[model samples]
Target: MHLPSRPRVATRPVQLAPRPPQLVGRDETVAELRERLLGSDVRPAVVAVHGLGGVGKTSLTLEYAYRLQQEYDLVWQLPAAEPAVLSAAFARLAALMGLRELGADAADPVDQVHAALAARTDPWLLIFDNVPEAEALLPFLPPVGPGHVLVTSRSGRWPRDQGLELPVLDLVSAARLLLSSSGQDDEVAAADVVSELGALPLALEQAAAYMSETGLALSEYLDLLHHQRAELLAQGQAWGYRERVASTWQFAFERLARTSPQAIALLRLLSCYAHEAIPSHLLLSPLERWAPRELFRADVQRRRAYGRIPGPPARLLRDVHPSVLVMMRALPRDTLRINAALTALRRHSLIGPPVDGAVTVHRLVQAVTLDQLSRRVQRRWREVAAVLVEAVLPDDPGQKARWPRYARLLPHIRTVLGPTSPGMDKTARYLGASGDYRTARSLFQEIAAALAAALGPEEGATLTARHELALWTGEAGDPTAARDQYVALLPVYERVLGPRHPHTLTTRHNLAQWTGRAGDPVAARDQYAALIPIRRWVSGPEHPDTLTTQANLAQWTGQAGDAAAARDQYATLLPVRERVLGAGHPATVTTREQLAHWTARARP
Candidate 1:
């Protein structure tokens, strides 16, 4: 037989019938692929089915190949992994095609098969199975002829127009597969089983086999699967004719480790963060630290070249595959463990495409990863009370407002700082300053009692605690006790913050106000006069607080029967207020009103 020199191009399209052991759960995909194959307009004619391992890429191809058997004179299923094995299989296929001489040379069997398919006057279909690497089969691919080539592989990149990405089974399909395979009649239970296995066909098959072996109900099987993911992974068992999904994952893991370790580490660290979607910046931080010097330099230069500015650190990170995230989070606990996990995640494609300039992991994956990390990393909770006090206690009302949340955490805060640390006093003061007087009073009492037990009643903290107790007691409506606390706190404020300090001035002002409220304007006038110069020197004359102090001093002077001096002081303040604040401003207006009242009194 004279073989045709050029590859035959089929003018008539092949009509492929749907075949039995009817491939379940991929009706849409199979039909689509079939229509594409039969369509007259298709060029560079080929169809490739690709997915993660054991997601039925090969099975779908076989079912379709059998469907089209009658349309082609020759059908061949060539294993693409081993070249020699593939050549032998093709040699046998050529013998069946009546091209017996084509098998003689092992060195060029692919070219021989190519020629055989090209020469055939009748149309043919060929199936290439497990072709994980596309480059290996480029030479073996049949020449364009009255024939079709169908390829199954994990790799997505194939002849541009010929690729078909096969997704895993959806829940309904997975349930159907389980029920059919397990011979189980419970539809509800089957769905529950499918959901637990992530609705992946490979997982469903494994579950079905487990159920078959044990004669277990689908619900019971689901529970076993839920509780035994790691155990199942450890056992390395296969189900029906399918290899274990865990083993497939391990293969992918090994491949990734060999090809890209950085991606792997990035994947792991991302498992620690809470957000499902994380910014690319999270990966960039560690990459800046761990990447090879030249690669790091190139990465930076590439970003700079593109005018791509990096963003702030990520608040959250998530993963696509919860299992992969779990594996990442299972790393050993150490200072560098989270960092290592993040590196692993980036190496693998567990993290999805960047969205709105942020890298995010899925929430489900993040939850699983965190659980795994908790098992390995004993979390180190820091004592935040001291830092919180420092951040919060600077006479800033904004900072003081945050004290309630901190105060509620007092018991935990106490343990973090150790029971006897000075942090407890600061914590108490924070509560007191924030107006959480009841809690502050109780905490102060506890501190005083504790200090009295450890040191003595005269100790600084104990004395301060007594002072706080007196203030709270006064605030709780006992004037006598409040006076006693102010008396007690006065010396401590002077001793600790010093007499000229703003804190000391505040204590003195509090005592004066309490005395006035207790019906002694004479004593209040003396306290008010002492505070005026100190307030001016410390807070500045134009300060609202200093102006208020001066106003209070004038009122006290008037109350003590010195209306003339009080009138002069109020008159002096009116001009100062107008100069510092505009005439229409509230403070200036108030001062004008005060001066008018005092002047009217002076007329008497």
Candidate 2:
């Protein structure tokens, strides 16, 4: 099709979609896009707005183009899903620039458009919408021009610092969209709908459009959504969109299923996790106990071959289907398989790329993915997820070194295991370590009550849960309550577990510590004095708990008005702490500092 020629290049030529009248939640993004594509200098600026499908990348780009089109002499929007269609689009631009005669004789019409746009002194903007790949568009970009090129793609293959990834709308913006699009004003119901829909723009728009069309109240829509989520997601008419939310994602899911079943499996497992950051490192840690030894060695060799350091161990395939185990074994290495799976999922926008070493799957994505699975398959994946999380949790939640690991997996643990599971004991400890003492107290209280009811009050787990509850009472600034609880529980521990048992000793230590913290340092010092010899004899002087008791004894002794005795005790304790815990360890450092303080007080 031949095109009619327009005036020469100085004349303004624009081919753009109409401006989006109300682009909620993207003002900042649009401003940043304008700044990135500003034609301030002679250098050509290319920025890629990358996001998952139906995230409104096209709407954002069109908004930027239409809002700022008047500042440029030329503006064009090119459809870039195919390289051939892109060339034809550029040829049309060439004809619009009055270069039809030149393009007819030229070997490549795309080159003619690029040269004309490149040579122009006036500013121009070219938007390459829905680019499938960065490399495919490289040849079509005008070299060293005053124009800005904006490309939008679902794939995040752009150079670092040149890509802007758009996430879903925030809660407020989503509510605004729901209400304004549907012409409804029920803020409460709007919040519920947006939460259910995961703040996804396309889903929100579809839901609002459905309500507007059907004369349904927001409350009715929400209730209907709960009962018929998949149907509602699929039923919306295309309100300026060719595909509804479900079909848009279904296409990606279908494509992913055909190309990367490993990614499909990974996504399914992720669906069973809470819709929060899933710690990628924990799942892929190289030190994972259940990783096949041969695969680990092969992965190490592979890393050496690539001149890269081996990373953490990948997750185990425990209690999973036999087919999954076979699939895992067929791969070269676990890490390689996982990385490939992540890449595939990212390419299709089915999962967000890793951020802060964690990946987040949208809640709606989780809902839809789980909804599509057979009940048996969903049950199996949920079981596999629980095993994966439990296997990665460190044995000691008290170790500060493992706090980040716990933090990353805590959400998933709470999701898969529920609040009262024995697994939550570690979560309660983690909460205490993180200074959330009150929350730890409440959690332990519930856990202790539940365990006592289920397993009998004298069961070991119930006693431990009660013990944690009392400990956090002191930590939460109620040392009197802590002291009283420990006072009541110590005899029970001694009678039930025997006096020399570690649990009884631990209870004794806490009782003494809280006695001092509750303002009776003399009594606390006496209690510690009585317990230290037994602790040393039973658990050894250098056991961490024993050292902890000794340290507390010195603190209480000083507080009980015996600075000289405290000085001598800390001096004696310092060397043991240094030798056993290391000189730079925080506990040893505290001992040294304490010895200096008490020595000064005693001398004066």
Candidate 3:
């Protein structure tokens, strides 16, 4: 009897692009890929790798294929960015598999290829590169059998547990890539280059390629990167990449512009901010709601008047430019629209997946996006960003409940409005409130100097900055320095703001507090005593500030060595504090504690 012969399976050539000439810093990922695809008990193990454009998804997939190709009887890579192109590639793949006759006989060549792979017992590997949608490849994927499937995409819509998101290269690997690709020996310059490029592998490679071709030193290349960013980013083509670094992102931007104009607008707005985590709540909230009315008034005032736009000028409302009016009216107010825009950007990997209610765009993405904008457009968005940030700040920065919000918005405020912005003073106060008094003091110092230089030493803004600097100095463990600073500032405050100004009175109060802190309790007591009647007269007897002054006077009097007087003073003030500030108020609680302590001391 004769046995039936099995059908002969042809050996097909692996069609992977050349392996990245050198794979740097992906040992762990490569290992994980091996375990996911080869170690699985499930047949035809499937995995998808996704990440930002230019983050090395393709390079990583290629490396994995090249490293382990020998384990498969057949390996093929197909570009899946477009349906028509992918379909044609499938036809070519059919021809390669010697399934041309079978495909020609069938209505769909892709279907024939899928069936052939399904029936085969020989191990196979198929890679789909640049897939824009996971469902687009449903028809092209071979069924479960003796094969494995790998996919790379910028989209993150792959099935859970089957997708791996690739991040940019680590700093060390990024520097090594730059040094090796450029054939340069400057480790320091290489490090700087990688940092500027956001440790993105494609950017590092393109930068290296440009340096290698031009023979420019790393430092020179870095200078060009800063001064001629758009030109430099558009210049170089890496060996294996069809598009330069800028083009890689430009394609995504163009796609977004076509599919979701709102997403493009959001990305431009984000470009105006520092490359830090942007809380999603900021975008979803109505722009008018986050941007206080005063911010627009200030903006319009600056545009109309030639000099410093001081305090909120209600008069500026009528003088507002038509353009400013349009911008205000155009402020984004639709939460659904904003959420959809965020989804669109995330779909293209233009922004990272939202973590803890915030998202981050890569620094390079920010730079390239800004470079593409007209100067006028850039300025408009920046103004919008600043206004939004300023509006979100709490009315009371020193409130413990509001400190977390301050922490979240501080980096954005500093970047959008600069260190000298009036909002920054609140941020400094927040830092001191949160107990980073040293940073608070240092930041206030910078603000004071900048304000003095820009607005003159005697400007109201400058005096306020100086006042904050002194207050934080006392809080930051330098009571003597704070005392001396207040001493210098009080006369200036009196001269410029007048002795009766609220600012002048506040300065007096801080001076007294710091003097007590600096070890002169008697002087502090006397100063408070003098300020009490004036505060009471200026701010009403039961006003919070007047009550604060009285409370401070009692504490300092006790410190000046009259415990009985302090006990009686607190006894008198405690009911007033409880009545005005509420029985549960922090000040009321403290007054009760102080009364009990001074009462006990009086007994001795």
Candidate 4:
């Protein structure tokens, strides 16, 4: 049967275009924000841009703020900080707009900020940057009016309709941005760079900036980037930025360690999975180990004091902070520590609030997080291979008899073991020797060259593998190839086990059968004649193998048209078979029947 080719998985990272200088690739988002700001239809009091950090939320809001500047008599950009600092900043905004406050604490600063916006008849625009919490800012947000308020945040609680989610740039926009930033006029090279960088605006920007600083061509920069992405992302000093991508992550990592140390460890643990998405339950094991009973009790007490939970179940103990979730989503693949990393993702709800028994992490995030996993976390990757091998092994009679199920999971087994694993070689031999000859043949050939290099030309295992390879080749309809393989193995077996050894005898017997199939009956007769005396010597006349070899020689003699010789041989073996076993025994009955048939044929 012809097997279909396995599908190849695309390993390249997805690329998105860079935001334009004025506006990136979010035309629809900008349009939606504009309509809500200017349109008379139930004008929302607040317009928000909500997403993960570095997703261009600030850029989108800034672009919209500039666009609506003419419509509003006053436009103010507010920096989000503590509530007290925000109130003070609002007071300063009132002073800048030339408003006199009657009392400092007539009401809360939130109420005061709202009153100030309400007092304005002229249309106004307020751009609030870096609002971390929706609840804290809710009191400060003014009621809906002709004026517009635009806010940017990393929080998930912002109103969805009014919120603009900034996804990464598409390929075309990303390519253009790389070309423009690197000052490269060649479209072809720029496109190549963008594709290689996965079209993420941040990655593209870093690549472009790297090229600009080093004065290297796009292709040369890409080669460097391919070899040294982690190194390049670590170079914040060269770029004059407070943090390069790597450092920004490290800052987040440090914060997580301080705030929620368990979650940080969980992030490292999750880095082990290879799948695009992993079930959330995989995190539970590490968390259970990391957070002990006494410490968990203390955490429950703290949450209870804070009124965070009404009851203390194990689930309550597992709740991860929102900030940690953001960090897990943002983590680069190579740097993620799998066991800790996945646990962190579960805690953060980045992957799941696992319903039932399963949850799936985003493939891209999972990949990036896995890339970040440390060597210690890599033990889990090895465990995963062992898990797959066990899961796919034929465990029942039906499974052993049915070849398709075993065939289907073979690739998964191969993938789990990886190409270079020592387990792969052992698995190949075990399957081949265990009667899954077809699969064994392919696996043997695949690893043979490597094994040859490592174990040398005349190794015992290599010779055995070649013998099996030949046997399967004959089964697969290549008798000549099988005959050649048997010939190759014959000398090796004789040298290793001696000519009269049982294994060597078996090899000779197989070679004779291949000789007959290859249309050389004379060679087959010679082999059978040699095996008959050897088998008789090894086990005497009563041995089943000796009798079987005699019977085989008799049948070949009959086929070669020597009926009298064949009858004589059959008559000699008949008493040995009858004396060794009962009449109903399968071998005894079969030999008696063969004698009758040869006797009848001779008479005719």
Best by lDDT: 3
The models' CA-based lDDT, in order, is 0.59, 0.79, 0.81, 0.58
| TM-score per candidate, chains pooled | 0.49, 0.71, 0.85, 0.54
Over the stretch 16-98, how does candidate 2's per-residue lDDT look in tens digits?
A: 66555579999999999888766334368888898877788888888888788789888888888888888878777777777
Ranking by TM-score: 3, 2, 4, 1
Give the clashing pairs for model 3.
Answer: none
lDDT of 3 at 358: 83
1 or 3, greater by lDDT: 3
Tens digits of per-residue lDDT for model 1, 479-530: 6667666877788778866889776787788787667656788888899898
Residue 264 of model 4, lDDT score: 57
| Prediction 3 TM-score vs. true | 0.85
- Residue 282, model 3: lDDT of 63
Would you give me the overall lDDT of model 2?
0.79
Off by over 4 Å in 3: 1-12, 39-43, 101-107, 184-188, 288-308, 311-332, 419-422, 453-456, 500-502, 529-604
